[model samples]
Target: MSASRPLEGKVALVAGASSGIGAGIAEALAAAGADVALVARREAELTKVDAAVSAHGVRTLAYVADLADENVPQRAVDAAEAALGPVDILVNNAALARTGPIHDTAPRHWAQAFRLNLDVPFLLSRAVLPGMRERGYGWVVNISSEGSLLQAEWSAPYSITKRALNALTAQIDLENRHLGVRAVGICPGWVRTDLAQSPASLGVPEDELLSPADIADVVLWVVTRPSTVSVGPIIPVRPVSKSAQTVANWELYLREMRSYDTSGGHLIDLYGETR
Candidate 1:
């Protein structure tokens, strides 16, 4: 292990790592001296993240696979382990959010959301547990959303699947706690990411939105704790300031977007902010 980085020699596989929260987490893990496997559907974007991960002098493997695919979870895990050894940490950050009322949401969209948000996490977690049990060590972090806890209207598919993901996190922790494997779910409130800037999420105050790196920092902190400490099963992440929920309409969202200027200020102040 590298004396300077607590995660030295560790291997982290981050799903949805092409951008947003997954990308942030991947960078953080690499900086902490962990080799990383970046997974997502976009090969070009994953390649970019791979470059950033490589800059930290740790190994990096970019795997372009949609998490919704039934075979992808185990395939990605197998490939990462083959190249970088067994994964010491698994970050289930991939998710799909299809906006609509429960009644209006199509069956296919609902299934897609569930597959990506809930089933993918389950599959990846299942794949890594055996290796983790044998090694007697591993960390699994599931990236849930505020919808998991809060009643976010017009997003029943997302909310329902994330709620299921929360249950999975708890069950995994309960079953594996005694075996040196810990699983935790992070429910982040309005976050400043491209995905969160959708028409459904309008009117969310800019001040209250969390940066992706904020969640990344929390993930790192959770995994770096003493062996005796097991952080699980859910961590609710709200920003310091309060924000409005979903917008009233698309016009409102468009108006807010027009007024929002992200270029002037840093969304994440790494040194000054407290988690």
Candidate 2:
């Protein structure tokens, strides 16, 4: 295989590939010489990504289905394998981001959040792992969010579901390592997707937000590395010291906690702060 086209002859199945980070990743993989199967509910957007993937002169298939449907994940994988050979890479980039207090959010929304974010990945992994094991090769790249770690306000369902995805990645890696397959969870902070417009990004400057290509570059790095490297189960990608809104909340929390510690001690103080 050529160094410029290290993924030549491989096939990648990417969910939520219609837009944003998914679209970016599908194109990146194709550019690296991998045939890509793009899965998403939006036919129009999916068509656009398919064209882009095809432009790389690699085979491309666009599967239009809502991953929240329990049956759709398997069918998507089945269609991909039939059309482009066995999938060497599976990217679970689909997610349902529900923002609201847990008490106010409907139970159905919570269920959907779990089904799309967590269950879909599990189902897809189950479908592809056996074939990957037989070939002794594969990569499962899960797109979790920074919300999973920060547990930001009014983001219970999103954060909890993504947190579970991290756990799922750890479990999949632990169970499948012997078979020569691996899994990793990618936790990205406010990137320049539609997510950048959310209230959570109140004071963030435009330049501070990561581009979709930024995340895609990381995915390429992850999957292209030797399987023996074990890049760890969770990879957290975030902006450097400039996420305004979330940091503000953290500052508030730290200030309050310091108040409770009445002792004029180092334990109560934030590491970099003079107070």
Candidate 3:
């Protein structure tokens, strides 16, 4: 659209792009002149984003694929390539967060969280990396959470998987640094998205939360930076807390108490004393 667009002629694939942060990022990329492929589970939601991206004067394709399904990532990538050409940019923004005491969490829930949060990104990266490496240019941005660096109570699976994802981001960067492919982890603190307001999440009001568009702006800046200057990691915090460790631990303690029994009285007391 605009002559100053940094991403002119580039192609991007944004996973979890039906809404929230993913949609915001997709729209921004399109505005910067990148043809985009929007991926999500719901075709209706993807259509909405596709319409908006197309209005920005960039080619847009809507592909519905459930990231939870192990085989879906490759299929989605293939379809995106067919529609928009080789992916020059990829945003692994799809994720799931489950908050509950480790002992109280069911095995199935843990598996689902791992698959969605950790496995999906890993698989999608693998699917798109080869083509990127061959082209001698590509950008992979992994959307992570601040919870990864904190020991959040009741949110064992969320915190664990995010931490692992961050580690995976670094590993990818190290391995592909010389291949013209770059990876970075974008960790945002509390964004006001539907997922953040869900019954299972900490319901921070929209007014008090970081807007998805805000995070998307940062993503655009990072990916559009000079290829010679690689941005390895970036953290964007809203209402910036001094430290997240204490808050995470306190939340964990309260969660542990909810599942405590008579035998856990001593453990509860210890947690109280520590807090």
Candidate 4:
């Protein structure tokens, strides 16, 4: 919105922007001077972020809508465009991760995951594609997860939906390459957010988890690249001792920590922290 900024004159719409990675991405975009529209289900949460983005000297609009609803994605896109102008950047960051064994998972749960993780991105991208093509410039960044690649033991629904979302990214990239519209998937490792604090996180320390801000920085870097260069999917992983497939073992992790400290009086946590 500010005329003198790098992203000045550009507009961005970020879904699931109430907190975590979505909020961080919205803030980063606003700091770069893009008028931002925040979409999430909770008005109260979005209002708080709205205040923060407005402080960056960019117009911020909060649109409360549930991505699970079939019609909400297009409506939210229309509202964002009306408020912030045509969306030059669309960030599909909203996702629902329901963890359970395949046999135990309900049919509704899988449907819900697909709705948020896959359908919303498809619908919203369709809503904005024509405008972006007409202008011959646009960016679509889909926030995927490492779970898409890893074997999800208890998180089958999440894994399946993310894999589908990744496929959608590739399809869009192939189809829109010549039109100046680019799409890419950003897969983040275990991020320390409200969503990550669960029984599955029992052996993991807070310091070992990646922060949403870290993932947001990666997204910002991807979009800020020269328009002439388009990157494919990116996976951002924090430094951790555990295998990508195995659940973290506290004892092993702690032993490694002590060994590093005894050897060099230095220790690195999972998120690349040195102490």
Clashes of each: 0, 0, 2, 0
Estimate the TM-score for candidate 2.
0.87
Per-residue lDDT, model 4, residue 156, is 61
Residues 176-222, model 4: lDDT tens digits: 86889989898876676786544243544566667788888887777
Model 2: lowest-lDDT 10 consecutive positions: 262-271
Model 1, 191-274: lDDT tens per residue? Answer: 778876752355455665688999999998998887899776899887665444322232244235444333432211213431
* Backbone clash tally (model 1): 0
Worst 10 residues of 3 by lDDT: 262-271
- Candidate 4 global CA lDDT score: 0.79
Model 3 Cα displacement at 207 (Å)? 3.1
* Number of the candidate with higher lDDT, 2 or 3: 2
Error in Å for residue 25 of model 2: 0.5
What would the TM-scores of all predictions be? 0.86, 0.87, 0.85, 0.84
Superposed Cα deviation of residue 259, candidate 2 (Å): 27
> Which model scores highest in lDDT?
2
lDDT of 3 by residue, 1-275 (tens): 34578898999999999999999999999999999999998888889889999998898889887888859999988998999899989899988877676888889989998998889999999988998889888888999986675654466687788889988888888888688888988888767677653312343333555779988999888878877877765453443533322343336344554544324322122134422
2 or 4, greater by lDDT: 2
Model 1 regions more than 4 Å off: 198-207, 244-275
